[model samples]
Target: MSLFLTLKVALRALIRNKVRSILTMLGIIIGIAAVIAVVAVGQGATVMIQEQISSMGDNILMIFPGSASSGGLHFGAGTRSTLTPQDAEAIMNECLYVKAVSPMVRAGGQVIYQDKNWSTSVNGVSPSYLEVRNWELKEGAFFTDSEVKAASKVCVIGATVAKELFDTESPVEKTIRIRNMPFKIIGVLVKKGSAAFGQDQDDTIIAPWSSVSRFLQRGSFNSVNQLLVSATSIKTIELAKTDITSILRQRHKLSEGTDDDFSIIDTAEITKAITATATTMTMLLAIIASISLLVGGIGIMNIMLVSVTERTREIGLRMAVGARSKDILLQFLVEAMVLAGIGGVFGIIIGGSTAEIVARYNDWPVLVSAQSTVIAFLFSAAVGIFFGFFPAWRASRLNPIEALRYE
Candidate 1:
């Protein structure tokens, strides 16, 4: 028999038991849908993480005070205030690969405007802080070097703070009290959603380091909490780190074999760590989802076996009428493929819709690629062939006399 006639016969056979055929394809449909949806969600999460990491800064490095040891016990990083504003200036002036540097002093207090009060972090930094952090002003300008030197009570509010305090009104030129001291709002930072660690990026306030040290917190004027360093380019980040470390060691006068009093955090390293974690999670989820496909293949094999047993006498009739065994095998194989192929097509449609619905409901990112869809369809077809072969071969090899004589 020709391929077309075989397919028509196989299709007719399936149509005769419509409910059974549909039930048999249910497993394939569910399996393919699940795999596609899981993959799409995983890919979306990975992309979202990468974007968050990139938004932190371009070729940035953070320098923090190293841990201090006392009584054989060691404190964590940032426990000491060994970093200073002078160190930041020296890095910009001496480090050839360094593009910009900012000294940071951190404090926390309630910000009061009119009758509303919101507690938030108050960071003391110079004008270069914005440049190093790749932050932009939404309403006003940053404080100048002279203002930082004079310990002026001028500040920049982030989007979250502005919204909390002023609502729809602009916060520039407004007076807000931090730590019971009034500060004139000089600028408002553009909105930055959130950090990679889930911290709210737009929930703090920025001011001169001198002001924060003098009025907001009781600390030495020369001491700073951290330094934000921007490299000339991504290619120069490592070189910049090396140069900064050497310069700081010399400035701090640390001898050989002595532990330095500072720690450097490269944005590239953070990005790599985050990407690695996301990739691992995606693969894990994909692997778990794949098990459903295997289960579905087993379902196909079981159903095909029942189909062969039910149609034993029909097979005997065909073989007795000169129909070749290979023809019988081909017809059954094509029927299985047709079932799987149709299920796959429907599964893709359902999966894409499911992914979109999930993304919308959860406000998450989802990407459905053409490549994944094609792979899923091809895999389904392969599963059908592998699982259906045994039952098909059994049907072809049946003894015609015994089949005809059976009740």
Candidate 2:
């Protein structure tokens, strides 16, 4: 028989048991939908993480004081105050690959404006802090180098702090008290939602490092908590790190054999680590979803076996009337393919809708690519062929007399 005739016969057979055919396709539908939805969600999370990291800065690097050992015990990084404003200045003046640098000193206190008081971290930094952090002013200008040198009580508030303290009002040119000392609010930073670690980025205050050291922290005037540095470009990040390390070691009078008193972190390293983790999670989810497809294929094989058994006498009658074995195989194979093909089409529709709904409900990003949809459909068709072959061959090989004699 021709391919078209075999397909017509298969369609009639499937239509005779419409309910059974629909039930057989259920597994394929669910499996494809789950795979597509999981992949969409995983890709969305990866993109979100990259965006958050990029908002931190452009080619940024952070320098923190190294750990100090006491009584044969070692303290963690940032436990020592070995980093100084002079070191940051030297890096800016000497490191060729460095673009900008800022010295930072941090303290925590209650900020009071009128009757409103909100406790937040106050970061004292040089004017270059904004440039190094890639932060922009929403209202007014940043503080100057002279202000930092004079330990002026000028500050910039983050979006969260501004909203909490002033509500709808712009915080520029206003005054707020921190640590019982009044500070003029010179600027408001543009909103940054959150950091990778889930800390609120726009929930603090910024001021001159000199002011924070003198008034809030009461620590050594020469010491800074950390240094924020920006490389000229991404390509120069490693070079900048090496140059800064060499410069700091020389400034700190570290010998060739001695350990350095500071640590430097590259933002690119953090990005790589986070991306790797996201990729692994996506692969795992995809693998788990694929197991359902395997199960669906098994269901198709089982259903086809029952179909061949029930149609044994019909098969014998067809063979006795001069039907070829290849024709019988083609008919059953086409039936299975039709079932899987229809299921795949519906699965794609359901999966795309599911992904969109999940993204909307969670306020997440999702991307549904055409490539994934096509691949899913093709895999379903392949599953049909692989699992339908054995039953179809068995039906085609049955002896006409024996099949006709069966109940």
Candidate 3:
């Protein structure tokens, strides 16, 4: 028989038992839908993470006052005020690869705007903090270098802090209190959303390093908690780090044999770690979803076996009327494929809708690519072929006389 004729015959056979055909396709529908949904969610999460990383200047490097250890023990770069504002200034002035640097000093306090007060982290930083972190101004200008140098009482508020303290009102040129010291609100930062590390980057306020130094001056003016630096390029991060370390060692008067108390972190390293974690999660989720497809495939095999038994006499009659074993096999396989293919098509629709709904409510980035949908549908078809083979082969090899004579 021609291919079209065989397909028409298969369609008629499936339609004759509408309920059974629908029941057989259920496993395939569930399997495809689950797989597609899981993978789509995973892809969306990965994209969101990458976007967050990219937003905070890909070439940025963070200099903290501690050393990273592998054995979960704290030893190096510990118990010292190792990093200082002088080191940050030295890097900016001396390092060729360094583009911008900011020394950050954090203090937790209640930020008061009128009667409405919010507890938040106040970041003492220079004017270059905005540039190093790639922050954008929403309302007004950032504090000037003179303001940072003169210990002027001015600040830039983050979006989250702005909303909590000022609501929808303009915060520019207004005064807010940090630890009861009034500082003029110079600007509001643009919304940064959540980073891959789950840190709300836009939740803190920025004040001049001089203002913080004077107000909370138990230590030296040159000393700071951490330094945030941005390199000219990602490729130049190693050069920038090496140059900064040399400059700091010379400035801090450290000997060749003495271990440096400062540690530098490349943002690219953090990005790599986050990407590796996300890739692993996506693979694990995809693998788990594949188990559902395997179960569905087994269901198809079982149902096809039962279907062959029910249609044994019909098969016998067709064989007796000059139908070849290959034709018999092809007919059964086509029926299984048709079932799975239709299920896969609907599954794609449902999966896409599910992912969109989740993203809409949660405000997460969701990507539903054409490649993913096509792959899912083809996987379903492959499952049908693999699982339908045994039943098709069994139906093809049946003895025509015995099949016809069976009760």
Candidate 4:
């Protein structure tokens, strides 16, 4: 029989048992849907992480005061009190690959705006802090170099702080008291919701580092909490790191092989680590989903075997007439593939809808790429062929006389 006739016969056979055909395709549909949904969620999560990290800065690297291990003892960030504003200035003046540097001094206090007061973090930093962090102002302007030089009590409030303290009022040109010292609110930072690790991105205030170090911080006058550094560009990140390491070590007079007093957190490295973790999770889920696809293929094979037995006399009559063995094999194979293909189509629709619903409800993202969809459909078809082959071959090899004589 011709290819068209084989397809017509196979489809007719499937239509004759619609319920059974649908039941057999269930495993495949469930498996494909699970895989697609998993992949879409994973991709969306990775993108969100990247966006959060990118919001932190352009070629950003944070310099904390101490390493995980320092002086043969455990020391976490800001514990050593080794970094100073002078060191940040040195990096800015000496490192060619460094684009911007902001020495940060952190303090916690209640900010009082009229009758309303909100407890929030206050950061002392230079005007360049916004540039290094790639943050923008929603209103007014950042403090000037003269304000930083003079340790002036001028400030920029984050979106959270503004909302809590001033509500709908634009915070610009307003005054708020921090630790009993009044600070003029010069700008309101644009809202940045949260980090990948769930830290609130905008719940603080920015002021001159000089002011924070002079009046707010309790310890050494010269020391800063951290240094926010930005490389000239992404391509120069490693070179900037090397330059920073060498300059800081020489200034601190560290010996060879000794761990440096400072710790550098590379935003790019953090991105890679997070994305790798997401990809691993996605792959594991896909593997688990594939088990259903295997079970579906097995069901198809079992059903085909039963079909061959039940239609043995029909098969015998076809062969006795003029149908070739290859024709008989193709007909059965087409039926299995068509069954699987239809399941795959349905699976794609359900998977996409599931992903969409999840994203909508959770305020998350979902990316159902075209490449993943095509691969899933093709894989289902391949599963059908591999499982259907044995039954098709068995039916094609049966002796016509024996098949005809069988009850």
Candidate 5:
């Protein structure tokens, strides 16, 4: 018989038992859909992370005063307050790869503007912060170096704070109270969404380090907390870190083996780590989903076996009329493939849309790539063949005489 005739027969058989056929495809549908949704969401999250890291400026290094600890154990990278504003300035002036540096002073207090009030983080930095972090001003401008030198009461507002206090009105030139100290609004930062660490990117205030130090008292911070530095290129991040370390050691007058007080966090290193983690998660999810697909394939094989038993007399009739074993196998295989193909089609649609809907409602980053859709569909088809072959082979190998004599 021709391929078309075999397919027509198989499809007719499926249509005869519509409910069973639909139920048999259920496992495949769920498996394929789950694969697509999980992969798409994972890819989206990875992209979001890269974007956030990039927005914070590439080739960037962060140096912190506290010791780096994970799971309550300190491993390394914790530096003492040996990094001063002078060290930051020396890096920019001395290191050939160093582009800009911003030594930070972190503080938290209630910000009061007229009748509205909100508590948020306050970062005391320099004019170079915008360059180091790749931050852009949506309105107004950053504080001038002279303003910082004089510890002027000028500040830059984050998107969230601006919205809360100004309500779409221009916040420029408006005075808001930070811990009762009046600060004139100089700039409003563009919204930067969120980071992989779940930190809000546009929720903190930026001010001159001098202003913060003078307002909060300079003696309170004997050592600088962190140094945000940007390098000329991604390749030069290591060079910049090495040069900065030497500069700090010489400036701080540290003896050998005392342990470096400051640890540098390279943006490229961070991005690589995040990508590795995301890839591992994706692989694990795909493996779990594949198990479900395997189970669904087994269900297909079981159903096909039952079908062959029920249709033994029909097979005997065909064989007695000179039909070959190959013909019998072809018919069964076609049926299995058709069932799987339909399930895969439905699964792709269901999974893609489900992922998109979830991402949209939850404000999650999600991208359903064509590769994932194609892979899921192909996996479903492969599952059908792997599971359906055994039953098809068994049915084809049956004795026509015995099948005919059976009641």
Candidate 6:
């Protein structure tokens, strides 16, 4: 028989049992839908995470003061002030892979302007801080190196600080008081919503390290709280770390057996860890959903076996009338594929709509890429072929005389 006649015969057979065919496709429909929705949400979340990481910095690394052990009591990292502004300068000047460096000290107090008061963090940092953090100014210029060297009482504020203190007024050239000392605002930073840890990114102020150390900090020692560094390139991040470790160790005069008094955290490594977690979750959900598709394929095989038994005399009649076994095989296989293909199409539509509904109501991100859609459809078709083959083979092997004798 011709291919077209075979298809026509297959369709006719399925049409005779429309309800059963539809029921058999249910598992595939649900499975495909689940896979699509899960993948879409996962991809969207990954993209959002990447954006957040980029906003944090480009090729950035954070160095914190090492832990302190006193009287057998050990405190974790950032508990002791072991770093200094001079160490940051040494790294910037001597490290080959380092692109930028900023030494930082932190203080927090209520910032007051006129009658308005807002509590926020005040950070002391060098001019290179803007580059190391990939921060941008909303208005006005950053404080110059000359101002930093002079320990000038000048500062820049974050977007949250600007809104709470200045309202509609531009913060440039204004003055805000922290710790009973006034500092002129030289710039306003662009808004960054939040950090991965859920801290408000825009609720802080920036000032030169010299000015902050002199006016804000009440410490007897010249120690810094943190160091922010940017590598020359992403590929050179490890090299930058090596150079920094070597420079810091040599400057501190540490012996070969002595432990270093600092910790370095690579933001890129954190990004990879987060993205990998998302990918793993997506794959896990997809695998669970695929189980239903497998079950649906089994349903098709069981139904096709029953179909062969019901049409035993018809099979004998066709075979006796010159219908080739291959033709019989093709008809049954096509019927099975048609069922699965139609189910897959419906599944895709339902899945996409469900994702859109979730995104619209919950304000969540969901992306249904063409690659995923095509993959889901192809997998459904493959399931049909794999399950349909056994029943088709059994039908083709029927003895014509014996089948005719079957009641």
Best by TM-score: 4
lDDT for each residue of candidate 3 in 1-407, tens digit (9 for 90 to 100)? 78899889878887888988787787788788888888888788777877888787759888877554556666655335778887888899999998899998877788898899998888899888878888789989988888888999898999999999888899999999888999999899999888767888788988998788778545667778788999999899999999988898898788999877688888788878887888898888878878888888888888889889999999999999998999999988887777788878887888888888877776778777899999999999999889988999999999999989867
Q: Put down candidate 1 lDDT per residue, 1-407, tens digits, no spaces.
A: 99999889888988998998888788888888888888887777777777777677878999999998899899999988899999999999999998889999999999999999999999998888887888899989899999998999999999999999999998999999998999999999999888777889999999999999999888888899999999999999999999999999999999999998999999889888887887788778777877887888888888888888888888889889987889888878888887787778887888888988887786667788899999989988988898888889988898998877656
Error of 5 at 227 (Å): 0.9
**Per-model C-alpha lDDT, please?**
0.88, 0.90, 0.85, 0.88, 0.84, 0.88
- Evaluate residue 38 in candidate 1 and report its C-alpha lDDT on the 0 to 100 scale: 83
Worst 10 residues of 2 by lDDT: 360-369
Model 4 C-alpha lDDT versus the unseen true structure: 0.88
Pairing residues by index, what is the TM-score of model 3?
Answer: 0.85
- Alpha-carbon runs more than 4 Å astray in model 6: 1-9, 360-365, 405-407
Candidate 3: list runs displaced more than 4 Å: 53-57, 67-79, 93-97, 113-116, 196-199, 233-258, 313-324, 399-407
| lDDT pick, better of 3 and 6 | 6
Ranked by TM-score from best down, the candidates are 4, 6, 2, 1, 3, 5
lDDT of 6 by residue, 88-167 (tens): 99999998888899989888898999999999999999999999988999999999899988999999999999999999
Cα displacement (Å) at residue 384, model 1: 1.6
Candidate 5 lDDT score relative to the true structure: 0.84
Q: Using lDDT as the measure, name the better of candidate 3 and candidate 5.
A: 3
Residue clash pairs of candidate 1: none
Compose the digit string of candidate 4's lDDT tens values, residues 258-377: 888998888999998999998999899889888888988899999889888988998898889977898789878988888888888888888878887887787776788899999989
Model 2 segments beyond 4 Å from truth? 1-13, 310-331, 395-407
lDDT of 5 by residue, 1-407 (tens): 79999999989999999999999999888888888888887787788788878877767899876465567678544333556788888888988998899988877799998899998888999899999988899989998889877888889998988888888899999999999899989899999877658788788889988878778544444456789999998888888889988887787777998866677788889899999999899889978877887878888888899898899988888889987999998888888888888889998898889889877886767788877878787878888777778878877888999989767
* Alpha-carbon shift of residue 19 in model 1 (angstroms): 1.5
Backbone clashes for every candidate come to 0, 0, 0, 1, 4, 0
